[model samples]
Target: MGSPGRSHRRLPQAPDRKTSIQEAALLPISRRQALALGGAALLAGSAGDARAASPQGQLTWAVHVSLAPTWFDPAETPGMITPFMLLYALHDAMVKPMPGQTAAPCLADAWKMAPDGLSYEFTVRKDVTFHNGEPVTAEDVKFSFERYRGTSASVMKERVAAVETPDARTVRFVLKKPWPDFLTFYSSATGAGWIVPKKYIQQVGEEGFKKAPIGAGPYKFVSFTPGVELVFEAFEGYWRKLPSVKRLVLKVIPEESTRLAALKRGEVDIAYSIRGELAEELQRTPGFTLKPVVIQGTFWLYFPEQWDPKSPWHDLRVREAAALAMDYKSINEALTLGYSRVANSIIPDSFEFFWKPPPAVYDPRQAKALLAAAGFRNGFDAGDYYCDASYANLAEAVLNNLQEVGIRVKLRPLERAAFFSAYAEKKLKNIIQAASGAFGNAATRLDAFVMKGGTYAYGHYDDLEALFAEQAVELDQKKRTELLHKIQRLVHERVIYAPIWQLAFINGQGKRVRESALGLIEGHAYSAPYEDVTINTG
Candidate 1:
């Protein structure tokens, strides 16, 4: 399939029942359906007409989080999907998840996996060039992979024995063993496959590169004001298509009200992460589009203290009680305006080899009993509940529920980056409302959160780790699926996590915007395919 321009309107298949988030949460896409969602390759035939289209206007975004320089560099991806917002504009990936497809070809025109599953090769697009006019080659791909120090880097490096540049346009990856999720990890899940200019990075040191990063994407970096905004200009020579908007500006607006105000006053073309009353107001207001993007991200309560034998959370009854205490349905209705799907597991239902667990049972009485059984008849001090500051409201709601069930905790909200940093460093204690919006299937999710030595994992279980290891090398699809499902079942049965729900992020678009690229990519919360974004000047 050819690379889709702004006019491309094909969307992924939705749940059979359109009734509610609760009803839809029970239905899981079959393995066949999940496999069918594989992305398409871009054809040069589509590029001619797309490149010929003249660029115009400017698009501004009132982003919910503060802009970080780390996001500008794909090699430093935090293992989450948020960085993709900037990476999509400033850089291009060999294989990327696009609208209507999960692993669409971008920098690499075509790629093939060896029959033995030990090697993979990609044919780089010859027409592709960085913003600095340097052609992307196999060497650059190798260099980028070698230099990747982001999330999952250690595992990627361990699994891949060598990266070979057979020709200028051909890059081959020879794995130490048959790792089935190689593409999912390298391409869709992490930024390891996102190509950067080899010659330019070598010339400019890492810090200098961050100051003025360049790429082969549709938009080129123009200027950046720390904690204020980022500016970009369209790169006409982009391999995919010339960006419809000539200028792109991303302004940091941490407050939801301020973002909404900016959108209402026409200060910004798009505003992200509008929730609760603000979201409702946006939906009711005229001349505005309130888009609820059903992202692949799932919010869950993580008990870092659970692994500690001396901690109260270590008791099975305590963990079970926490899971039972959550009123997820009410939270979904109140916060997401009933648009978010109530999740039973962190692994998204749309992913390959997904196992749909039973619907969550909200039983406050049972929760109280479990706490009593665990020797906490009058409740226990669960210390602080750490969460992303932007989702403090959700955390507050969770805390309220936990309070009622005798699992008392204080709310400790931190900035997004700070929270991740603290969590990664294992400095955080007590409860953590964690989430993952990164792309990939179930095994990848387990590797990061459940398996030992993961980027964000606090602890691991021996049995689950064994299962994970077994699935990693299992070449048979049927056997692998069974092993993965068993692992998820173990997690569910043990109540390792108190799942909240799959997020349905609310965003606003102004009347000036024609195509915001909102909901263009399945499970991506932000407006994307920045090249396809257009405006209505008339």
Candidate 2:
């Protein structure tokens, strides 16, 4: 009946023995249990919260983590912070952003397109070297892509045919079609993470590659303690100058309170992703550092096309009604600690050309009316899949709001891994929410969200699939802009998915920790370049 807050625990689970990426309860629980798992938010409704430093030479960096990385292979999982580290360090790409936010220049020094717009050529930097000290050749670029083609995770394979290395320093990508953001999607901040050392990767299988990734990054692997720690020392021979900080250490601590407590006690250098409730407390405890960079990202809603027929959401009206009935204003204010702004498109406003925010019209009566029109005047029951404790709090508020609208909705809270898998398989009830994008440009953001094989978006919608393909390689600005707008509108009309907000987390950085491997970028996590980062023990 009332909103509540929880602490240090997952929301209660259903008695049934069922688990999936996004697990549903064998049966929904009473309201009281929901609050417990959301911590403060589940209990009340709103909630809370990387990497190591360099080791080589003289500096040692220490970064605190709240959880073990879900995965370490960037080529495979974009969501894993461990793999993100590899993306910048061991591999090089066609394009990367110049540090201090200048032009794009990561791996490829320069590139050009054919007159027909179908083929794009990138010239690799002459001096770059991989972690194993192999001269980066054009074939390695081709190898990286050839590997990408075998998987469903990447969209690049569909449009690109092959890589041709005319010489040691030149790698040219021949695209099946001309794409405006194709270069950016793969090389820019939005696309291809660095290439892995090919021969070594083949030598060691997927599992070995994850453990000891040898990248040309500023830092190199030192030691890993599984769920507890992973350390890397500086690579002075990095293409860039020696990093100011040296060794970087990643410390894993899954509980939020323990992490915040570690920061206050000066035991951990950073409580990386801060939970919302402990934020005020952490800030109150002096010597804590706050770096509030505007992240280019958004929270995404996942609406499955088909749900169980007997569920309340079996009707489209119920689905649309829940969307309209959700009160984001209250949830944002109460749950996010006022750190985020409402997002319009999957792209963050930080981008150069984010589309205009669509008119936000919130009407619970209309939501109910829609349900009534769809034949549920008396209301029905369903579930909301919460990916985390913090979101569970926000979801509970949404569930609370839906209750007000006469729709009896239950909050189904899950651990992050299972939650993601459930949504990916489209097995959850027709709706769920997740953080989405912050690509540097309109093209990159839209492609990541609507692109055929994007991590966040479901690729089933044919019109969306067609629009994304055309928008990517389309050379004309006028036509590209029009297509982007059409795609956004089309997604809105379908109402299967929508944008919530671009968010920044309140983080706890240690007083003793100095920067080594912690390179901040557009979004959260270790997805940015890890060079020039150093950790100091002195």
Candidate 3:
């Protein structure tokens, strides 16, 4: 598939007055979406975007989604973007994502693989110290790895035969097989990379640790109010350069207008997840700057019930028809403001092993023909199309497109927690408009989303499972790359899921804040290396 070029559109002029904050929150879509349609024109005519020219002091960030203590624990964290926002602030991994690179040294200063590829050794950084004044040791690394009970833990347990510490500052992992993506697997972008103090957790217990978490990251957890706010202070004892901001406050502002209003009023240093006309307004306005990043993920449709042969979705023709109904270009223009690209396969284009198939062609006539051949010419009720409220606009757009090709679905919006919980409990029915942002190569993504017994997968295919298993242990880079390509081709040919487009996150920053280091790392959606970020004083 051909790569799509970036496009820009001028923001329409703002009106004289702003809508009431209360009214703005109740809109069908986000305040940014409403702003794109001229509902909140006050943002356009507002004052200049400039702010106090300083990089120091407290940095208050207004996040678009709410967070809870459930997400703070690295061991229990489910794969999602919101939780990682706090995780990045309060924790450090053995290896972290370097600026523009996927993996770099962190707690583990250096690492090497054995000649046989089954055993890997890491030389732990001796200077690293936790927030509580205790030096990080190899035992802490072993404990943290064993304590992990998250979605990826099963994969780790299956692949890792043992975690051995030869010395206080040296740790080694003996794998059952030669996993080709071991470095990416243990990178900070995933849960396995996060290291915690074993002594502290043992003394405080899991519940107690969540309330007052301690880590060896640049920031130390001060306090947390579930679903509302979290506070962190710069860790002076950090091995790396200390964070410029003395205090960091992550305020959970679910409403888009509230976040924007906070940024406009200079109440917050940064506001995340701003999109559509609001992003454009920030770009045109003087005091605010819009930072757009294309994350490595795709907003696609999943048919959980399709695994059952009785369901219409079980038919490939029906699934292909559903995929064909989506107009990727139109959806990208409407929702992303032309900032996103149409996804050609499950693996995002950013990955090294990403396979670019033919670009998706929108053809309602062909889609109708497929559906008719599958015995649904007039379209069948697909039941509720459930998704998190954050994706309301995208879900509605998909529903409209599907309706045009005779695949009817009603939008059922749920709170973020409820939406994720439903999927975790395997209660999701009919079609689900969901997304996956796992950071790694194509093999990592395919294993997590499509392989048998995968955390996010519901369907099972023995042949595909065999291929994935083979690729996971294949040491030859060329052979592994070819295997990954084959898996992507199978996913595309089977239409396992209807991939829509790759979504980009738009962040609004007050001019006072110069976030030079804040950007996607290994396609991480919530990456913010606070230690490197400064609130520009000039």
Candidate 4:
């Protein structure tokens, strides 16, 4: 598969498979296509193989962002991958993207889609048990799916006709129509398929369950202090294998300086999102390793006010000015030391049916001319620009460029959680620097960020919406690709978003950490497959 950052290159697709849902006939475990669909898990060793060391010591992490309680609950996952950082540690999904495969079988050892594509079946693993000693049955899978109230929950529920549990191990989902993205959406793209204890949730209630969550993952929840830290202990009964480390601790360190300070003091084994000079320092320091993980998150400047006829952004020239004003190359070099790939489209090149737009031309004179033509000869106040506080530097950089082109705006940095909440509710106006790191291809990206009623979309174009609808049910692979490509091209031509770049998340680890698990999973910014992470006991 080609990197999504690579322009004009067609991403490789799995052999003998079509992107259309109507033609997608998935088989059970052991088949090549089934294996392809179920991305291969990042297993440390074969379950039967003897390990050299028993689980020991504690592995602590200094995370770059605040740990939101919403992340602990798979039921409320947004249309992003942030929650999965915690979910991978505390819970197990039916099928999930692991190191190499996009939809690896986890709890459900095998899954198959019916020939007609109206139904899908999953064969639950018989050996798995929740942290509470209760068996993970097919009922749990059905319960979890039905209870999901996450980002894409409504669309999923509307399409699914019924969920059936024929036995303790077999769970079937009958859809109202043939949805080609069933596996992609349910398994990897959304948390709809991440299983939870059926009886436990009912017994404890939603609030209580969140207070003390339990799952069939490698780690069992020990404690959680809001805005501080989350602690977990190894779950011996975890079906995959015993975790390498006995204890895991995730500490929230919102400040980059403080995170690096913690890492320098050996207070944390791993630190995430270290960038710029701090990254250079980490690379220079002995006994420390700095890694740059190229993630799928492509940042972009969104003009929510563009849809409003009364706003200056309603004029195409003004939008184009904003796009042309950005100095992408300099921004990349300054922030990531040129590690981040300058993005040309909202859709990453790695995605299926991706359409690469022409390279972004940064011409301040052209931008000024466009703004002047839009009747803003002396510049205009563009209201508040909302962004995650963690990336305030990025927002400032973008603001500086826009200001140079007469599009003045004030920076409004919110905490990561609040920023997302505000964006989703459409409370913030003007420019929004947004990014989506969720799994899936071009179609999923379009559905979430471009289509009408998308979780993050404030408005939609009628023609684009129609094209999206037309492609949703199109069974022909070539036709689907063409339709998707057209939608992307239209978005680019209209200057809906000023595409930034695919992020190169610079992270670091100490000598005590044997396997940080960083960069092991492609497109995942954080260290993952918690059970595979190990620390030196000696």
lDDT of 1 at 172: 89
Better of 2 and 3 by lDDT: 3
Instruction: Point out where model 3 deviates above 4 Å.
Output: 1-56, 520-522
Q: Find the 10 residues in a row with the least total lDDT in model 1.
A: 1-10
Per-residue error (Å), model 1, residue 65: 0.8
For model 2, the superposed segments whose C-alpha errors exceed 4 Å read 1-70, 79-86, 89-92, 98-103, 149-154, 189-193, 306-316, 359-362, 384-391, 406-418, 438-462, 513-520, 523-528, 534-538
TM-score of each: 0.92, 0.78, 0.87, 0.92
Residue lDDT tens for model 1, 1-538? 1221112222222322233223323323223223223324122234545345688888899999888888889898875778989998899998788765676667876666666678878888767899999899999999999999888888899999999998999898999998878888887888999999989988998988999998888899999998899999999888777788999999999999999999999999999999888999998899999989888898898888788899999999998898999998898988889998886898887778789999998999999999999999999999999999989999999899999999999999998888888887889999999898888889888887878988788888999989999999886778999999999999999888888899998899999999999988888878888987998977
| Model 1's TM-score against the true structure | 0.92
Off by over 4 Å in 4: 1-45, 48-53
Name the runs in model 1 displaced over 4 angstroms.
1-45
Find the 10 residues in a row with the least total lDDT in model 3.
1-10
Which pairs of residues collide in candidate 1? none
**In model 4, how large is the Cα lDDT of residue 70?**
83
Report the candidate with higher lDDT, 3 versus 4: 4
RMSD of each: 6.3, 15.8, 13.5, 5.7
